[model samples]
Target: MTEGKWDEKFVVFLKKYYWDDILQLANSYPDQRSLEVDFYDLDVFDREIANELLFNPDEVMPSANNALQQIDLPVEKKLIDAKVRFIKIPNKIPNRDLRSKHLLQFVAIEGMIRKATEVRPKVLNAAFQCMRCEHVTMVPQNEIKFVEPVECENETCGRKGPFKILVNQSVFVDAQKLQIQESPENLKGGTQPQSLDVDIEDDLAGLVKPGDRVIINGVLRSHQRTTREGKSPFYDLVLHANSIEYTDLEFDELEITPEEEEEILALSRDPEIYQKVIGSIAPSIYGYEEVKEALSLQLFSGVAKHLPDGSRVRGDIHMLFMGDPGVAKSQLLRYMVKLSPRGVFASGKSASSSGLTAAAVRDDLGDGRWTLEAGALVMADMGIAAVDEMDKMSTEDKSALHEAMEQQTISVAKAGILATLKSRCALLGAANPKYGRFDRYEGIAQQINMPPALISRFDMIFVLLDTPNEDMDSKIAKHILKSHYAGELSEQRKNLPSSTITQEQVDGHMEVIKPVIDPDFLRKYVAYSRRNIFPVMEDDARDHLVKFYMDLRRMGDGKDAPVPVTARQLEALVRLAEASARLRLSNVANMDDAKRTTRIVYSCLRQVGVDPDTGAFDVDVIASGTSKSQRDRIKIVKEIIKSVGEKHPGGKAPLEEVYAEAQNQQIDRQHAEDLIARMRRSGDLIKPDKEHVKVV
Candidate 1:
């Protein structure tokens, strides 16, 4: 078709279908310079024109813009260089599938923004003044290299000479570069995720940051790869964005049919729903019933509360597993990642501080300027992040998680880029004990290599010790053997004929390890509950939680008693109760939910917070790395040293005298010696000589 005909058709189409939209754009001119037109509307108006626009955007875009300019509005001022942007284009392509055939064609691509460059002014039209004749020339710019006029535009005096740029007169627009990668959840095994560069201009430049899932409609353009030798045969693809739509809504990609929704609702109504959910998580792993229960609740997390004062209470739960080497901690974590609709699994040994949080790096598209890159936590926004081997990470690297786990945001202030990115995801971290095995006599905080402050942030901490028990060990061995047998049979069945291995034999072995609820259905169920269910605490439930908290707090009423729990545990109880209600698809948390949460919290506290010596709950064991009894003994040892040192020269007390004095204060001889050694190791007390000690 001729350009005039195409222009005439677009003008008629606009007047017929977009007259009101055009007037609105004109009223908001300069501020809203682009008018978005739906591709469906265009297709409905003229299918041929729509097809032409999809296949030949470069030719159709100019005609469409010219037609838009011809439209006259009642406003006093005319729209200056208004744009007509297409959206909801039917030709959707995956980043990995983009090919040369799709070049110059209008298509839509969906991915997460892995990196973004700062917005800067890019010249669209250059205004150059010819030095010879003092004549001004306006040249359009499109390629990376700047274009200059061959000669002067003035016909009276044409000369090829240097020209000075009139920066003020040049037409420039805000432009940014983005690197978008395919979502990890969508990739098949053994395949690396593919990424594509995108160029967004005007109002779309600063609208998206790293970790944002977006569907962008644009024309795919290719540039030849050039090296120092010359141009290479390969070409790099870049999308010139026309319009972008954010898909960051939770579980937006999980499409639940009406049948599936009904199934989920039906499952929630089952009497043994909690049991089924627990059984579904790592069913092959022998046992850790309470751990699996907590994981189940973590999937259907509590509602995030946004207070009117602008503060936010994170509803996501954080859990830590510190265990022996033979335990299946990493297996449980990997299974959770598979069950989650959106999840990222990162190993601490391989991930740096910036890799787990966010990084500011200089990329090719940034032209030496720093580009902010999203990390595992940010990529797992609104979902789950399973970090395995957390003990292998350096202290400096692990510190990066403190803010992300608490505030649900990653604040980056590197290389002039200061921005807060969302990391509202549940953390499932697994670590090993310092000595490769737990010491039942010591506090959990002392056994784990992590700091107490970080340890206290976890909603629940489970210690999976490899204790010897005949009945339990036998059951675990059987479960492991059955799982391996099932896997072997499945592999054999794939290669052997049905006659060689009957289906019944394979099914018999698989039944031992198969989950009660299908994994895919479970993932959809979790997404549905999170999206639709926001349970409010009932009066009865609230009272129950308050009573439980008070009962624990009352245990520490005496002056010498240890603190049983802190307010953090109370908040965790509330979150767990809410999650319990969500799992049942109930709108209110009742007595049952409260009771269930209390049971789980009590079990966790008994494992990690109870002081071995006193056999009493002391939150300080996890909060301060010292139990009440231990602190008291240390205080007595300090006073004894201070008084005993006065009797000797240079304020140095003999070790035997200090121990004897501590024994007189009701501390045992063995306990007193251990305290002194601990204090010496901590730098609180220094050994002045072979047999004397002095406080620093």
Candidate 2:
């Protein structure tokens, strides 16, 4: 109960468990604001003492603090109010698993900080002066709201009258509130992560930001909810943080052993590594080898570059798969999400603009202050985001991703809170064709419900048409049949008694539908490659990329022709080549890597950016509404419509006559109708009747 007597006990406690460490700390403090004591050591010293310290932290922590102050230092090194923190409890609980039994008991909790409130000065001990007797009473404020002495402590003057808080004598500490949520990877099935409030003060305040995974040693405490009706029976729990620590390694949530790293490195050295990786992704989906290869490279992305001029070149490759229904596009996206270490999967139909980027929200989590919440892209920073049903997203929501795709940043300027958050994630987006089926004659961009500007941002776009080919169809059918059989066998085995299943039967099923590499191994491999490798473009690779770009541009024939490609494609080739090199675990992209990526890019361009009639690549088809050939056709159609409308009555041209004239001009009747329909959609022409169209 006495000040110096408590200091003596603290000294004895320190001597018992940390005698040697105290000497080292005495030399380190003032420079170091705190000394971390392990709870295990305290528990080892005396179980009852540790229990008392943890269960009654308020009474015991001051002794620990006084012990720190009592340590003797050199003449010039006297420390004042140096903090003593406890960490590394024997049993740590996950944020979602906290129970009522732990209330007021010291516990270690682990989670990611989802939101943090601003640090403000909170009065810990208030000095109140009684108006009647001028008696000053020191009151400890322990509740959520500040408290004052009910009556003057002076025995002679007992009154419930007003008392002014003595500002000069009050003790305050910087305090902040944090909402810590269980990490997503820790959740089971479709369960939503649980969250709990944490109160951090003094040296621990402002120690973490949103998205940082941390472990905190604290006491779980609860307080009754206060409302207009007065204090209610409902209680809310919070962890009063004592000390906090974060993982030292980036993305340490994904644990990989040294042996696994060796296996990944060995696998990369194989000459057939590329093919193996491609085969590993969604192996049961059968076919789409080119698309699978592209997805493989996307997992091991290129090295991001920051030039001296303060501009950045992103190394993340963005890929889009616009295909027919039942082509397994969503399956591929889900596979990639499982493969990447920090992958985030979202559906455009369900995700909002703020849900996909970042939003400034005012909520109780921040105590009514505006808090910046990270979206899927931001949460997937330094990794990959797989967005399925991308075509279904509202245009307003799609606009939010423009800056995030290229610049790798999301800027929020709302609610007087301006901030820029890093996305830095490769996007693997899938969408169904707008018409519910692919049209071979239509440009890939035209089939998707996305703007040209957004379509052009993707580095590679693949169109998966579900054309009936007896040969390929049989292969896909066989693959699907085998996959279904494997699933059926798994379920049947689960239902059967132990004697009914045999290892031979399980082996038979596994052999029929197994990936070239296991999913867990693939994840570890990707993590290893991304964390260690940063490939640079070799001279020969650069030459090949430049030559490829120039050759594609030359295919346009002349300046009047539509541009075959742009600088964006050039960057894409480099990124893909670098990714290829990373896949091989090489530091330099060789000529082979360049050639492979060039072929891949060519395949993608021929699918999405080509003029189907001319059989030539035209970037305008995807970047702009019309290509050169299409533009010329539009001009001819406009002329024919004008001539026919002028020759006819009421500015209307007969549909049959227009088709006949179009056929005479070397255009098929169907092609002519398609163009006319497009023109009508563009408001260039109006159909007065089903049989007649008028020039607008």
Candidate 3:
């Protein structure tokens, strides 16, 4: 009698036919009639129904008592009608806990799951967020878990970490995973309808169409899928997260409001606010226009602590600013910290590794369990984090942030807690060129406080040279004086007209931009980036590489900040350019962007890259003034090896003996070691023995 509606009848049939024990209702919606019930539990639960019903702690059902009897704790206990006998047993035992290792054991046994695994159903909520400004969000509260840890490349919002989890209902149970189409036909307006990998098995992989949130249990990858035979799979299943469960629901039938619709519309129209906050103070710090531009990008696109719109942050955008003493870098950094919605600016010497990411500290709240304190990056996630005096920090502390900057997530095993935190944020940083001041004509790398591996992750770096000129110094002094004493400089801005867009509006942009990118140009561009652009070899290679990037971008409508060129290489290309372009608030990637990225690359390349002449790239050429002695030592080492054997007419000497010779010249030990490494790499010298040296 109640089965007249086809949808309702289908739901009933599925419940009775597909599942068992269907009476207990899970959470529900407005109309019970519209609800689809699960009767037969699927292989979704981490435990059996019986075990879960018995042991689960969150539920409040009477069956829970019958479900679990008791667990035997490690301490032994016995009772015999008020009479007891004591027995002693040694602590050592044979193979007390011998079990084969499994991935699940790693996650589950380590308390990922508090109960035994079982067949079950799962429901979760998630939101799609823009990585840049955080002005965009799409939350499907009644959906499956679709959030995976990722670095957010939301334009200037260098925020990174665990992104919004998609709701359970947004998943598609019957779509297919599409193939990667490289042809022009597929390339133009290339957006294929989104489908699930498990369903039709032919939809686009690692992609989410507008208003679409996929719920699957593997890491979501962003590129093409292929096999061992060199043949492309119909779909590239780029993994985002693993071990999945799901349910899908349509949005139209849900109780969505027009206000929500309007918010979505408004978000679609707001121009990309990849423009960084200029914090009036930064502009006041004269000279270092290049450094200022770099820092501006850091506010908009570097490793920030948060997204501008207050969304989850993720992904790569590391940056550093090296300058001379009295360069006003710290003052500028302090101002930037306030401009960001969520930001932290701290001195390098004052921070610990734990303070940079996480710390197990005594919480004054009085819970004896030590609590976790998120450092500048973690707390500033989804926003900007300005670090002052970078070189003064400990090497260990600097290393702690390497993963946070690149991975956009912070995993810590501190106190009694094993936790992974989201820390996707932009980073605006400052440092002295060395313990003293910078050297004119030198790249900032000479005095960087961190490691080279860490250095490479930054989208770009800038040198804040304080070259004193008669005109520039006077200007700087006057500006500082004005900022300090002028009553006109109170921290206030002229009231701008009401912004047409709200944070919520920015969070709702799918319906607008979807039509713009239906061709999936972003995907192709990303592929091209990963495939080609980033690892540049030579000048000609850079020329050829840029075309692929330009062509891929030409494929997309210019609505966003030359949005995601899927490839990390493409990101490098775009990032380098955009960091420059952001300086003047231009929406497009202009010459400035190209030059900025190229300069940073050039600076880095100059340090490690080969030069045709003199057989050395010459850190002295780039690392000019920070340390004359260091540069001299690099040259000295080359000269020494070149002079060895040929000048004295003897077999090549041991490196130790070479160092002994260097010591005679009053060379510092650290400087001597560096000289040897560079000499060995340059083919000027070789290790005949582990410690012995020879001319190459």
Q: Which candidate number has the best TM-score?
A: 2
Which scores higher on lDDT, 1 or 2? 1
Residue lDDT tens for model 3, 218-315:
22223344579875745433222222222111211223346744543343244532221222225545455445545555544521135677764343
Model 3 stretches with alpha carbons more than 4 Å out: 1-281, 302-316, 362-367, 440-444, 481-485, 488-571, 576-696
Task: Give TM-scores for every candidate, taking all chains together and pairing residue i with residue i.
Answer: 0.78, 0.85, 0.40
Give the worst 10-residue stretch by lDDT in candidate 3.
106-115
lDDT of 1 by residue, 55-164 (tens): 99999999999999887778777765788999888899989899889999999999888888889999999999988888999999988778998988899978876899
Best by lDDT: 1
Model 2 lDDT tens row, 1-696: 555665676677677777677667667765567778888777776676678776777777887887777676544565576777898875588876777888888888887788888888999899999999998999898877777678778889888858999889999988999998887767898889999999998878888888777888888999888989998998899888889977422433568888888888889889899888998988878888899999999988878999999999999999999989998999999888877766789998889999999888887865587888989999888778999999999999999989999999999999998999999999999999899998777766677789888888999999888889999999888888888987777778878776476667877887756788898888777777777788877898899899999999888777667789989999899899999998888888899999999999988887788788887888988888588788999899889888988998898999998999998999889989999999999999999889999887
Q: How many residue pairs clash in each candidate?
A: 0, 0, 101
Ranking by TM-score: 2, 1, 3
What are the clashing pairs of model 2?
Answer: none
